[model samples]
Target: MLGKLKDLLFSASEADARAADHDDVAVAAAAVMVETATLDGTFDEDERASILGLLQRRFQLSDADARELLAEAEAEQQDTNELYAFTRAIKDHFDHDQRVEMVEMLWEVVYADGVAHDFETNLMRRVCGLLYVEDAESGAARKRVLDRLGLSS
Candidate 1:
């Protein structure tokens, strides 16, 4: 599974990306969460927990369901070539607030390690634009997460 994710996120082709449709919105969103968690090259326990918590709350799932979604997301993320397919599905299926909430989820993953790296923030920026999320909203979401985590922005 680790190797699959690395190959999907770190290396893939347009053909692989097009096949990303295998993932539904929840799975796609989970994939993006997984992507952010692994982007810093750690994939630490903290980030994993954050992703699980977010999936649970966002989808209102039981622990088992949440874990299943995460696993499915890991597989989906690993099978894809790009993030665009997921983002497009999300943008098409969800409303503006839901999209903003996703950005918030991404920020939570970014800060899961207690420190948001340059690459993480850069990924957040790109994802915000791809999802058509306004910069101000993304910043607000970041602040909300920081406040919840008791971290100073």
Candidate 2:
């Protein structure tokens, strides 16, 4: 029936739109993570590996997919000096708890090299503000990450 065909087509397009939205969110998150890892003027293997693992865990991506995402995100991040676009995508897509988790993820990337530089810390503060995550919550997330990594906060 024409009606049935229309429904099928509409549903397929709707699903495609959702998939695209999901991909946008994923790329935005990965780009922010890449920035976090590289903000300290160094992009070492440990930071790359940490971002790869975090991307895998956060988005449930396979190794190959995560690597591809990392590459795409790095390119995207390099192309833009503004964090607003990436943060806007994240803020629009993620709920408050997820945003907090994002802050935690940034914290993880910051400590990937077993040290947190001033620039990285400043970046986190600005990101948290943009994401509307409160300072107390961001501090708590940082503490949790530090505790997990056996580091003193």
Q: Show model 2 residue runs off by greater than 4 Å.
A: none
Poorest stretch of ten by lDDT in candidate 1: 14-23
Q: Could you give candidate 2's per-residue lDDT for residues 10-78 as a string of tens digits?
A: 999999999999999999999999899888889999999999999999999999999999999999999
Local distance difference test scores for all models: 0.89, 0.95
Best by TM-score: 2
Model 1 accuracy (lDDT, Cα): 0.89
Compared with the true structure, the alpha-carbon lDDT of candidate 2 equals 0.95
Residue 41's lDDT in candidate 2:
86
Predicted model with the maximum lDDT: 2
Deviation from native of the Cα of residue 44 in model 2, angstroms:
0.6
Taking the tens digit of each residue's C-alpha lDDT, what string does model 1 give over 19-102?
A: 454338889899999988888888988998999999889978889989999998899888985999888888887799999999
